[model samples]
Target: MKIRNLRLLPLLGLTSLISLNAAAVTVEHKPTDQIIIKFDNANVEGNSQARTLSTRLNKKLAFVRKTSQGSYVFRLPSRENFSSVKAYLKVLKAISGIKYAEADQMMFAINDLAVPPTEGIVGTKKPIYDLQWHYFEPVGGMNADGAWNQLDSSDSVVNVAVLDTGITAHPDLDANVIGGTDMITAQSISNDGDGRDADPSDPGDWVSRGECYLGSKASNSSWHGTHVSGTISAFTNNSAGVAGVGYNKINIVPVRILGKCGGYTSDIADAIVWAATGEDNPNKAQVINMSIGGAGSCNATYQQAIDTAVAAGTTIVVAAGNSDDDAGNYTPASCNNVISVASTNRAGGRAYYSNYGDVVDLAAPGGETSTGARNGVLSTLNEGTTVPAAPTYAYYQGTSMAAPHVAAVAGLLYVKKPSVTPTEVKTILTSTARAFPDSCVQCGSGILDAGAAIAALDGSVTPTEPAAPSNFTAIAGAGTVTLNWSDQSTNETGFYIEKRRKFSNQWGTYRSVVRAAADSTSYQDSVFGGTYQYRIRSQNSTGDSAWVVSGEVSVSRN
Candidate 1:
């Protein structure tokens, strides 16, 4: 029966193609200046009636096409007013057949924003605040001066989109905000008016409206969106609040999605699309930060929206999630196109609450809970109504805080190399990451190195050479033989060496030696004393190169 169904599909395809001739006619009639509207469900009976109603209201309304289910697509006049569009949708809603009508902006959800400490964590001895950054510095091929110097030319006018709760009116964020929109409703998402022009009243939290379920709610909260915005691009050298990642020159576009308990997937999707490419509205964002996510499979609508954003020249940075599960369980983070970031403690180990997986592109300083060691991330915070003093600076801890660091760095990179593609950005980030202990499998690329990423942007750093092996000799007096090798390089922080018996087709476990300088490289084996094969490679602050193999030596213990 399955085979027969497959056989009939081709015939059905042909029939559909044949009937598409008239459908193709509508494409030509679509207005170049008009925005596109797509209903969630076109098969609803009201949708068909809406199509007919559209024709009566204006001669400019022309039916464009229909989905396989018979939902109609119509093109509105280029000059149609916003009120008219709303009235038309209201008319359709009054009909029983229509489900939901939305402009093209309602498709993608924005990525949200991260660090921290203690035993049971990797790199526990190191300070959590700079662990990941320090780890990536050498591997990223950057020095202290190179890292700090790159910031000057990289953050002039970069734009980063904060897609979360609405950003409040804070002095630090005031200069950085470019523009934004509200996906939950047509009203402006900013606490201020349109285009970051004026301040608006913040409506704190809301009860679930049966439209979406975002889980629990916090009793006390300052505008999350505003705080996140300040962290990424707050005005630098400002006498008031804490400094931001990209200094004051970077621009932020806030797309509010999460409000009350949680946000709806539908609304979040729209924010993602609009934030990246400025659909329906005129605000085009260069980088999108999604600090919030839920458990569910990646939907087609969301994936399509992300693809559109990437094509339009935007870099999406997403949090791996606080659930502590592998990133595969998350949607946009797991999505192949975007950069998925995991959380690490200040000590440079995986954060307990951070999600892990091979899909994770990088790790940052996400704070941990067990050790009383707060990750202490510096960023802006809302002062609340009583305070009313612009956004204040504070230390936050979480994968949420860590994510913006990467986003801010990406923004700086964009400013330096505007021509860098999303893929190249990902490469620069991943390739320069620092490896962490016990993080070999979980951390994916390694800790994100801002300096290394920037240095590699223009190909200014020199690549490190691979380390050599030493002390090749067989044990005397026994059939079992032991061989030793010495470390041959200075910058080598770790050694990856492998050995295999002569007759065996596969090599034994590949050993990773850590923190070894040019002086140390020795391996002891208790196997046959005859001829044996060996291979060694060195990894350091720069990166690991190809393994240098030893000559096939013929030695006898007897």
Candidate 2:
């Protein structure tokens, strides 16, 4: 079952509802008390049969909850008894209502469970750098409804769990960051531990141990985790070095997975599970951002871990890789759950470095500077110094930077509408995006529309079902055909218009016009005249909107 992030408001006095102890406990060794069974849908006929089979299973084992659509929770007698459960499931398959079933393995928490600092005192300030050199720009989405104006009052604190290289304790991020653990070694991964007081020795960077033609050219301390964290929740609006997407209220839960070279797939999976629900952590985060990914097939271990995180009410936002190839090759991003984001340039076109496919959920502004591409984005960085002087701020380009924009927006949406599920948040962001030229088709759900998304929080313009485009009217004026028609009520962000000659029987090329809420119900088509056939389709946040056809509007050039 797919689970999206559900923002839950703070209860009046439930401050002590949960607590995480640092002392290691024998988690895996603990006797198994529950059994989670994931089944194949093809094995069962219908929901009625599934329910009947569930009842039969309950006769042999105590049932917990039907967590997802086809998954079930059961109380097991012991860990060793898991084999018996699997055997029974196989036997029951012949009983008409059963498919394959197996025992759910216990997963450890991936993060250190510790209470994060509450928003209050102002910390040391970092210095601001030149913006021209870097591509940093204020997020446009924050301008809607003056959301950024009330940065202090609104609970802008978002718990971003970074499953990447460990963050260095730089001056800019020191205050906002809590402690993290090293999943690779399964030991305390803090920069300073035991007697060692706050040592700034750990410079978090990617290193390649083996020799290759690429050599050490790629070997550089990116401080990637630190940079990504700052973008999402750096102490912004605080007269510091650089402003973050949000304000100072944001907190980061650092989960280190990537280190020298790329990290292991097993470690990544463990980190994701821990970050989302605090499965093994003492303190859990609300949102998890995965900026790193691999180009390979999806693994069963990772998929199961993702399922567990979603079941516990965590929203997983992943970056569409930088390969610039079909996104289907990427696993977790193409996985059933999680929100996959693509990169867009400032001109509102898809970045050449971004991966695209039917699986792409949405796109954001990933700055491009190498090829003279510009995308205005805002984020945080570390000033390498012990004394609080100027925090190192920079403008970075990558799907890495773009992912946080969506995460921050998600945080704001959570603050406004707490009931919205993760899936719903994905829906809102995708459906309400503003369509730019060469944008609708190349990018999944158009550009990220923070303003339109926030407007959706109050249910102003609700999304409708998908429908096809129909009917075409052509009005020739000023060397352009003014195309006008009634808007479709479902699955439409805008319309795609194409032109072709009647004799050739071949449709000329086409360009897309994003439908805006404020625009009148007409588009001026300037390129074509004489006899022509036109077709249009509706687009939504999920992908392309269905197409409705209007027979043909004959136009005579005046």
Candidate 3:
């Protein structure tokens, strides 16, 4: 996933009526020949305004067409200047009777593609569970296993639309995939030789040197959409391959928008709108995942599409980009009404390349593979370089990988509470996320806690005690003992540790008690030399959990 730096094309004009304030973290708009504008009235003389502006600027603003959302598209006269579009946008937004105006910025697939191992059976053996550490590991994983326990076939069916390149049929993933639309309108970007079709198969987006823009390097096809889909709903319990966060119960709608050098904001926005109100698709996507983005302020086109989708009860999840800059500088991620997610690594910290800022809504295991492939997010992929090839699996690291974790969990939430609003879904995700175990500045409320999020949706379930701490160990020193264990619950208010004297044949009554604060994982004791054993349990407002006992340890007096 080499990021393609698109050079600015000639300025164009369009009008829109959706008045959205520009994102707070505004930057120079990305180069585009087209602009979307909204006039105060639906049936305004848009051509008249275009003519007057054209006269003032001495450049023709050729009208393209009106959008379903009432915005108008206009192409500007061809020019090589990068600032020409921004300069024209500044002028167009201020024109009388205009409600909103913005450049039709290009969006990109936010990822750093990792190479796959050369020698290994694809699906013969299960993907090592520990290799997929982002799912179950307490320190860095999303704890999706806990959510899987709570989810079953009885839960409502959730449709998740993955707006990415498209899907490559994989033995492990095709079972859950349904028909999707190809939303890329431009043939050059679509790479499929056609525009807007029902078949959503991915035509490889391999680029030659400098094909996207000056200095852009050549790269292979990422098969990014399949990997993302696998993360969301890859077949599980079939005795092979990796497990999905959705537990193989959710349906994946592959909405192909990104291809070649990535996709246009217009196509992505249209896909969002279609997911919301398209009558052609019966299984309306309850959740939409956009693991793609680009540098820019949130614009009216993105905001309006998100608003429309949110109004239709679809929870939109977007990548916070991978630029290591403010996510507010990216479209859709910075757009209002979408849950923007930042990337965390296997160390439970912000990924080195993850974008972060106030606009981020949550964090998830995006993975870091600089050290090894085992550390990255592994999912279904293809062996192709320029076209479709044999299906395979590979590890990919980026905010693109992180967004699906949240999106999959969102699908789980929707399954549990089918009538839940988009805002409520966002609330449960952010509110229930656990505090980051490592430093991740401005990485949203916290890393996503799947089990906690699923449980939070049910108000009637009785409160339960926190899980008992495990892996308890005691190391004895002269007149002292140090005890340590792992915290196993998210609701513990504190921990209660009790110790007993070890006699020749048995242990004495456990009387001595020590209280450790919430989230505590260790405690040291100063004691007279003696043989002893300790037991501990996590406690909360509900009750104390079952106790876990440690092995006996002997101490010597000084």
Candidate 4:
């Protein structure tokens, strides 16, 4: 394995900060009235299973199509009533031979405003270095400058797939971009007059007032894919507008999924599979950036797609979301086998609008334009209101901005260690992250330290016995006791949860009750009227840590 050459661009001008109000954009996402079902068997028997489920639920469910991940899409006879459709889903889930059933939820870009660039100095070609504080500031930046100095310069290019509104022709980014495809299946959403074509250029995602939903405000085209691609592979040391974290060694594969009023989960899922397995790709994408998402639990569609991609050795990185809520409430962010990134401000604190929770894998510089435009992440953009226009740069703020930073770093890691698995990449990234300089509760291990992550590829960062779980607690319920703890180790494969009943041995001898997956912070155990104490420890192939015990809690009712 070889490391790519990283050249740090010289800082030219004074830091120019612009204080601009972040746009108030309401990008609501909801189910598309279609249900996705996966049967135990997906052959002819699958159709039979669907028919049997329709008969059981007493609703006319029409087969729509098959998703790339092998899930079957079905449409109810009437879209007028969604309550009945949801009710049918409940019945469908209970039917045997059905693997899973869920509504095809919609997802949108997780970014806010896209304000045009502000003037830096009177006249100079280095406005970008002064404006892009999120990349080099010692307090809040990801320290890309330090990471660049550590690269070996003898490695091959790394491919990163950007799944978003698609890419536009930007002089700053086109050189590093490669062949890509549009994966949007809906004609209305594609907005380009066709569906699933070879062209991956963004056709603009602008929508009129109430176009997305009732009373929804009109929105301009975000050129989101362009911005994200710029963050990953913009030409470095070219005296260009802004510097990319990948140092121009990343080849972006744009897989367009989001369109007009956001995109469908089914489409995004298919895009993930395609981006991971497409044979036409010059090189397999080692890292995928999903800056687009919505409010929802991790459904089967996304889980299967993500699992498939990870199994194919692609490290997926997703935004934790911008709703300022727990990231566990979002889809791919909550989904297993991906790096979920939370947003941070220029002050190195949690951004005002970033999602936070145990699900988040780490934090990155997403930027907060509310403080100042210069504080926001600067990236390539198009100045068109509804279509492609003159190429430009802008300041944008959101988890959408943060994900590409991590993805770019992941690309660099892959360049250094070509054979590393997706899990290894995630572990290195989380373990190498530096502790947050400011308060950022539940923001995962720490803020992304690109220099540390890159340097970790030298085998200096070795895995050891994981630290003991912290904040262990037990709460008594009607007939069950819920055990909760915080994961403190980045390399742990899972958790060993042990519990002892008060009546059995005075809480003296504990037995392993459950072995939860890595990053699992909570578990529930049913009991028949007895007090119990719990303890948890992080486990890996290397070893396990000492147990962190919890107080006794009694479940009085059964």
- Candidate 2 all-Cα RMSD: 18.1
What digit string (tens of lDDT, one per residue) describes model 1 on residues 39-153? 5554435445445656655445655444222334455554333455566656555655445443322212221221121221322232211221222223321122233334453
Provide C-alpha RMSD values for all models, in order. 18.6, 18.1, 12.9, 18.2
lDDT of each: 0.53, 0.51, 0.75, 0.76
Off by over 4 Å in 1: 1-146, 152-156, 186-202, 206-218, 280-283, 385-390, 437-441, 462-558
Tell me model 1's lDDT, rounded to 2 decimals. 0.53
Which 10 successive residues of model 3 have the least lDDT summed?
Answer: 1-10
Candidate topping TM-score: 3
- Badly placed stretches (over 4 Å) of model 2 are 1-146, 149-156, 186-202, 206-218, 372-378, 382-391, 437-440, 460-558
Give the TM-scores of the predictions, in the order they appear: 0.57, 0.54, 0.76, 0.75
TM-score of 4: 0.75
Point out the higher-scoring one by TM-score: 2 or 4.
Answer: 4
Q: Candidate 3, residues 1-558: lDDT per residue as tens digits?
A: 010111111111111101100011123344566677888899766677678768765778877566657887776764223477778878777778889877777676633344345322223322233346687655687866557656656777789999988999888789999878898886777898998899899988888886765555687777889889989998775555666788767999999987886776777788888887766776689999988877777787888888998998899999897778899878778888999999998889998888899999999998877756567787777767789977766677788889999999999988888888999999999998988989999999999988778778865352476798989998899988899999888766556677899777678887434445565688777678889999887755334588889898889985
lDDT of 2 by residue, 1-558 (tens): 110010111112112111111110111222233444455653333345445655665534555444323455455444443355556556555564334344443221111222221211112321232121111212212222123422336454556676655566545566777655564421122222321122223344333433111222233345566667776666543333444554455567777765443344445666677676665576476677777666543545467778777777777887776667666676566676788888876556776667778878888776554443222343444433322223344445666767777776676676566556787888888887766545535567776765467667657553443465445566556456666667654334334444555546555543223222212355655443455555555434333455544444455555
Question: Best-fitting candidate, measured by lDDT?
Answer: 4
Q: Worst lDDT window (10 residues) for model 2?
A: 1-10
- Per-residue lDDT tens digits of candidate 4, residues 8-36? 23323323322222221122345365688
Give the winner by lDDT: 2 or 4: 4
Compute the lDDT of residue 260 as modeled in candidate 4.
89
